[model samples]
Target: MKHAALTGISPAVIAELKNGRARTLELTSAHNIITLTEAAPGECIFVTSVNEEDLSPGDPGIMVDLLALNIGMRRIEVANSFFYEERERMSARIKVQFRGITLTRDVEGRKWGDPTKVEIVRSACYRAG
Candidate 1:
């Protein structure tokens, strides 16, 4: 039997989660960092507290949606997203429709004047369900 596709969560974390061990998943954004702890007894996922690093002092931070990752026999789903702040804060959710190979380049801490020029590289092919 084929195993579920692994995305954001690492192999070690998955193993621990399956074995009733506690673990934390850290996710960082442009200006803030969030940590996801274990879910409740029946729940399989947890969400992190909202971070407001990108917001100015006294300004309310944009509320991000709850993220979920499902590992199943037929498909895997990872709710990943990125947030950008301009005059108005906007969020871009990264979604994949099918199981396929993906390539990513990490440019953390790279300084660039133009944010729009930056891009995320993704390539995928969908299989019939």
Candidate 2:
């Protein structure tokens, strides 16, 4: 989750955030908020502790680093229809952080399963390194 949250992001996603299509996101294992397009390359995004936090959408316990503009933090978790409200509450009631990236997750974040996870703050493409 940390790896992807820091890397694995695509230019299109970044563009979306820049265009307002995407703005907030969540992380797995915890309900925290993170902003896409506010983070930069070569940074780290931190969320509430995995065990202590709920991995829901809209959590405000998300934060990122501030590097330049090559890249920015993006949403990582998407909530299921069954657990929307629960996720949003958690997402908006916590605190998180990123290493060098600039934005933080928002209340209505997006989620992508593992494997596809990408930490744009710490990675570039989807090629196995």
Best by lDDT: 2
Clashing pairs in 1: none
RMSD of each: 18.3, 14.8
Per-residue alpha-carbon lDDT of candidate 2 for residues 27-101, written as tens digits (9 for 90 to 100): 322312234233444454443322222333332222343233322233545668676432222232212223222
What tens digits encode model 1's per-residue C-alpha lDDT throughout 1-129?
A: 111111233345434443432343343332221112211123222111212222112221111122342221223344446654334232222212222222222222223221111112333543334
TM-score of each: 0.20, 0.21
**Candidate 1: Cα lDDT at 3:** 15
Model 1: residues with Cα > 4 Å off, grouped in runs: 1-9, 14-101, 105-118, 127-129
Q: Once superposed on the true structure, which residue ranges of model 2 sit more than 4 Å away at CA?
A: 1-41, 50-53, 66-129
